[model samples]
Target: MISYCVFDAYGTLFDVHSAASKFQRILGNKQESVSALWRQKQLEYTWLRSLMGRYVSFDQVTADALQYSLQVHGFQEDSSKVNLLEAYKKLDCYEDVQSCLNQLRANNVATAILSNGTLPSLKTLVENANVAHLFDQLISVSEVEVYKPHPSAYDLVTRKAQIPKEKVAFISSNCWDAIGAANFGFQVFWLNRNENVPDVLPGKFTTIYNLNQLLDKVVQPS
Candidate 1:
């Protein structure tokens, strides 16, 4: 049985694109492009840093990625960069997050956030969204000094919950993250919110379009 229902914080629980959307007045028509590039670069930087053994906090990576996105889009104003970074500290949670987490709790399942985000930011995010109490833990990759898709990062859940990987249900909107967790032996669920094609990776996992669908898969029929 799955004892813990662990989620990836950014795209899984919190809306990563919401930060740029908040600055639509300034970003104009490029808001979506900026948001997309920012997310893509953020993940790339983490993977690149991990492979190079040059670990930096997610905050730095976030800022660096945003800076690149802004520059490429001709948004050179310092205030634009500053405002977006601050906004990131309190990203809007997904609509399904609260109900899904509540249902998991009602089922007597433990919930946590396993994120590439730093602990402080993760805490700020959940607290801002008014869902902080719903989670039992807010785990950061900083603890292991590595980012997700890495074995050591996925191992954080098992270590913190004191349960074997087989007893943990790992959920993520990112295909790569679900693959990583599945490869590490957890029951992985890919929250494919966008209906995107799965990545051509080695690890195996079940795909679900939304958080509510997760209930059917993990919650055994009583």
Candidate 2:
């Protein structure tokens, strides 16, 4: 039986696109999509930095991505504007994420958030969402200075959760993350909210449409 559920934070628990929307609306001019570009660059920089061993906290990486995204997208730099754009760090949860989390918690199953987010951002998110008390643990890859898709990150989770991988069902909206955790021996569940094709990875896997599907899969009988 899966007694523990581990989740990813950004695109998984929180809508990461909120930051870009705030940016675009604030800037008030863009022939281009600032949100998309910022998100793309943030992921790109994360992977590149992780591979290069030039690790910074997720908050720093996000700021750097935003600054460069501004230059590339032709948005003028205003310190206040840049700080507001970093509002992704303060982004709230999706429509009823607390309900899903509460469902798991009420069942006596342990739940955690495993993400690349830094302390300040994750703290604000849990507090603002009023779901901080629901989480048994909040694990961050920032602790290990490596991003997701790296086995060590998942290992950090397994170590921290103190639960064997098989008993913990790992859930990620990112297909690659589900793949990574599976390879690391967790019972991985993919939340394919985007309806996109599953990218190839080491572990063969199963998917669900959203948290409800995941609940059906794990909480319901096998």
Best by TM-score: 1
User: Superposing every Cα of model 1 onto the true structure, what RMSD results?
Assistant: 0.8
- The pairs that clash in candidate 1 are none
Model 1 agreement with the true structure over 78-190: per-residue lDDT tens digits: 99999999999989999999999999999999999999999999989998999999999989999999888899998988888898889899999999999999889999999
Give the alpha-carbon lDDT of every model. 0.93, 0.80
The best candidate by lDDT is 1
Off by over 4 Å in 2: 29-32
**Tens-digit per-residue lDDT, 5-120, candidate 2:** 89988888888776655655566665236666777788888899999999998888877777777788676767735565557767858775788888888777889989888766
Model 1 has an lDDT value of: 0.93
Output the lDDT of residue 134, model 1: 99
